[model samples]
Target: MEINQFLDATYLKTASQANLTEEETQQKVIELVKEAILYDYKLVMIRAIHIPLVKKILNEAKSNVLIGTVIGFHEGTYTTEEKLKEAKAAIVLGADELDFVVNYTAFKKGDLDLVRNEIIKGIKLCLDNNKVVKWILEVAALTNEEIIVISRLIKQIVFEDFGEENAKNVFVKSSTGFFKTKNNLPNGATLEVMKIISENAKPLKIKAAGGVRDYETALKMITLGVDRIGTSSSEEIIKREKNRNKGY
Candidate 1:
């Protein structure tokens, strides 16, 4: 398979997170968009604020690389209403997909209603606007059992309420690439975590985000049932693929 088709070229770091000035961060985003246009990757995953900029550039270049953004971001602590508001604004700004961080903390606390309600509302907003939606589970923060349950929860809600036909646009994404785990453990998609999510969230697509730095790991994640890969290293991965094809 063509790796670029399965890649979501991502750059979601904030200025503080990368220790760069706001202008520098914006320049990086501009460069990312140019790369996406040049490579023709499936989508450019970025911050909502960058959506308008990306849209402008992609349009100017007449490129079809999609625009994806996050809601409730690295932390799923925001209220459902707040997330919805953010999502609505993103759609208005021309985002093609919305990756929402599921409130897994509430799910772990056994507040099923809070978690379920947010998924329902957030997904409905995306579907209504004809935009793709992904639910980020932040796998490192949850136990294996929690991962299975949450993935199943998203699947059940989508299939039962939103109808199966819409499943193509709904993805159960793994990670925000920002969670700080103890001992510097992998804070992204792992094979074990992805297996649990894949077996349970089927029908709904899977996006493996975070820690996917090289071509080999990205291929393995796709082989293990990841429908899309969210990574900041798209250029390197593509370069490695080219080198391997030439027997480098």
Candidate 2:
């Protein structure tokens, strides 16, 4: 299959959720997701607890795409146990993929084992749900060398935790919409993870988020081995795609 065919959209509908009521947010999500599918874009749900409700919407729309939820999102403060609970709960409610935030505090402590174990727990929880797990490394928090180390640690976790299934499910990501170091995302970090993704995450997927504002940046990532693009800018991106099509 063409990798382009495998490219998909992950919608971070946080502002929509905060700005609108649950029902309103969900209605808009359904409309956007249906539109994405019409454009042959695979849908990856981010944030918003209304995802399960949209699962039926996808089915009705005849869209065969993934429904994802963020686990311990935005910040990596959630403990290993909390992450496991969140993952299981999300899966029980129809989440097909779990994008788990890595335990940054543990990583900061140099507690590599704790980091790996937490990741393993998340992987197992997703597996139990008969689903896939994507580990968002939040690479903007890590230095260049740190990205490589984290990538290697992820490789080891995949090798030890759940074998090929987990590896296939795993994704290395640039940011989770918020950054501890930078107020906004850095393209250098985005390209840093792309470099790691190209060199390390061969079978694994790469999702680039944080400051992806236009079609050019998004397309550059897709061409560079990124499998998924997470953005709240989906509407703008699609409009750009359409304008490019119209050549106006």
Query: How does each model score on lDDT?
Result: 0.93, 0.71
Q: Taking the tens digit of each residue's C-alpha lDDT, what string does model 1 give over 1-248?
A: 57998989998999999999999999999999999988889999999998888899999999989999999987899999999999999999999999999998898899999999999999999999999999999999899999999999999999899999998989999899999999989999988888888999998999999899999999899889899999999999999998999999
Estimated TM-score for each candidate: 0.98, 0.84
What lDDT would candidate 1 get against the real structure?
Answer: 0.93
Output the number of the TM-score-best candidate.
Answer: 1
lDDT of 2 by residue, 94-200 (tens): 88878888886678779988898887777777776678677777776776777778877777778776786556677777677666564644732366567775577
Query: Which stretches of model 1 miss by more than 4 angstroms?
Result: none
User: Which candidate leads in lDDT?
Assistant: 1
Model 2: residues with Cα > 4 Å off, grouped in runs:
1-8, 11-19, 180-189, 239-248
